[model samples]
Target: MPRYSDADLLEEIRRVADVADTDSAPSLQNFRDHSDIADTTVLRRFDSWNAAVVKAGFEPNDPQQRIPTEDLIAELQRLREAVGHAPTIDEMIEQGNHWPSTYKRRFGSWAEALDAAFDDINGEAVFESRAETEPDDPGTPGPHVSGETLLEDLRALADELGEPPRFKEMVEHGDHRARTHTKRYGSWAEALEAAGLDPDARSGGTQQVSTDQLLADLRRLRDELGRVPTATDVVEEGTHGIATYQRRFGSWSDAVEEAFEESDA
Candidate 1:
């Protein structure tokens, strides 16, 4: 990743927002199209794209303003034509007019949204359907795999790999694509939880189910990870989600700092 300073990032945000020609800041996808700097790099400098936009002197778009479902599907179709394949979540975020979360709220998940847009008049899915390459092997977004089966397979894979299996690891060894779990459980991390596998073996063999003071718990997690624990880590391992932290402490970075300071105190 390019090591642009904070000023470079803010300037890029302004450039993207100006190209968007709107009063509100451009979405992350829009920023990506207009600049060489990555969205992740910008986000790491600030806790969020919205925070970066605010620092750049533009108002971020209202996240709650729902796009019409039809418009979202149309954008998906356009991206499909551009990429010449089924659009993945990354592709959607990078190229589509709207974000993946918008589609998730509309159709329950990104895969389901593809079905909505590409399903034939006869109810056969066109975009995400797997052709039966073999009697037993249906392709990706393959035949519906049950949640229990997904979790069980995750366990079996963890036993084989001696660690929590990433989505890519399951490609060659799993009954289906590791990402198939996301269709059932929303994400690979959740799949690991459902299967009871720990990413860091040092984290013990189990997740903490404590409801202690938020700062103390955050401190504990940072100690366990030996670094700042992301919001997803809290959701997967801690007792509360990031939304709860945001409500109590304003922002995730602020909460992390306060938690570390409390430890010093």
Candidate 2:
């Protein structure tokens, strides 16, 4: 390779740090796996690999500090619940305690990590067990709705709930079953998009979210906490992401005030 500079080496370390899935700090081996530049080059300029890592602003990696497989899965499930969908790498970073890299390290890959989580979540056979209990087509007898009608219902539900509809929300509150949506659009996220709604990506700043929804979720958090909730409470345990509230209401304080003001009213 052409002669690399110290800046190049350190930057590569930071680059790997940003994208590497592990929550633990990047190690020299991680650098090797990702970089075209040599580790020896990193070592030649710096006293030690970690010395360079510090310069790049990464904490030293601790191989011993491993998160339990079960904990990782549990956090993934929590993330899914919080966001109302499968957890993504970015979601994991934002809400999950463990890093995606930690899952990759523990489960051999992020895909496998998600599979293990999905299996564990669905009790080892999400489809098989649900199939045993529920009918193949849960698109059961309801007022027949065309795709256009479904979109109308979805938009209507968003207006009613003050947020975009989730799969469960649609099943419970809208005129159609969740199955009908997936049948029409192949996924709930797509269904929301087809309805001209965002998939809570306030997660999809895109979080199902509106002032009323945020207030309800905050009230739920308050009941759980049994005290006034802080922003940390909302982020750590509330139904909606804290950022969603901020985006919707201009501040976490404003969101909480709205929730409580409604209760007092």
Candidate 3:
């Protein structure tokens, strides 16, 4: 096996951390599985797996042992009280007893942590409280989701459904709604267009490339892999990323369907 520098090993650990769920902490197994470097190599380089994980800016392996979950929750409550409202991640990072990641590890997500803290204080659900407190929904819009984030979510949902999403599909299958998209981009079609999709091409074919070219590429990949290419497969092997396909044709499934249609044609 090739020897990796300490910086490379640290970067690999950070990558694992990035992909890990907010409620869970990254483990040695995660690092070993995701990275090209072996666990033994990591141990040898850093003197221990935990040491290597620590160097990557993540909390220690037994974070709950070091800082009790109750204490973490208590600190979250304290921070909320200090701010007189739900504290943002940056505020928690700056003012709380521990890093925001600690809260995430303890509660799956920062929003969940806030909900728990709010519940603890007021004995009411966060959603119910929000509804009661902010009667005017239009005046108090939800958190600002960036265009890039919205696009990323759209592509992820497309990958999951195997096709580009319709307005109703987005409301049903996606985290955000048509109204959210409309608020951000004026219309659902505009959001799709902004995400690199041609809203006019409702047949799941894009004007960017000829159907023949797309079919040829799909057939070529299928021949190479000896199976139908998944979105991940297409991204790694094809000219365009999965998002590109979703944006162009509405979804990866749609793209595949279009390829078949072209083949028949």
Q: Each candidate: RMSD to true structure?
A: 12.5, 14.8, 15.8
Best by TM-score: 1
How big is the RMSD of model 2?
Answer: 14.8
Q: How well is each residue in 1-265 modelled by candidate 1, as lDDT tens digits? A: 2235688779878878788785567887787677544465576568676788889987776554635677888998898899777676655644567757677777887668888888642223443343333223523333344567777878897888777765656766787655456434434554566677653342234454232467877887888989888765674465444544655676667888888776777
Q: Tens-digit lDDT track for model 2 on 140-187?
A: 322233568778888998888777765657667777565556434534
All candidates: TM-score? 0.39, 0.28, 0.28
- Quote model 3's TM-score: 0.28
Candidate 1 residue runs with Cα over 4 Å from true position: 1-70, 82-139, 166-183, 198-265
Clashes of 2: 12
Model 2 spans > 4 angstroms off: 1-60, 63-164, 170-196, 199-244
lDDT of 3 by residue, 197-221 (tens): 5543444555565556566778888
Better of 2 and 3 by lDDT: 2
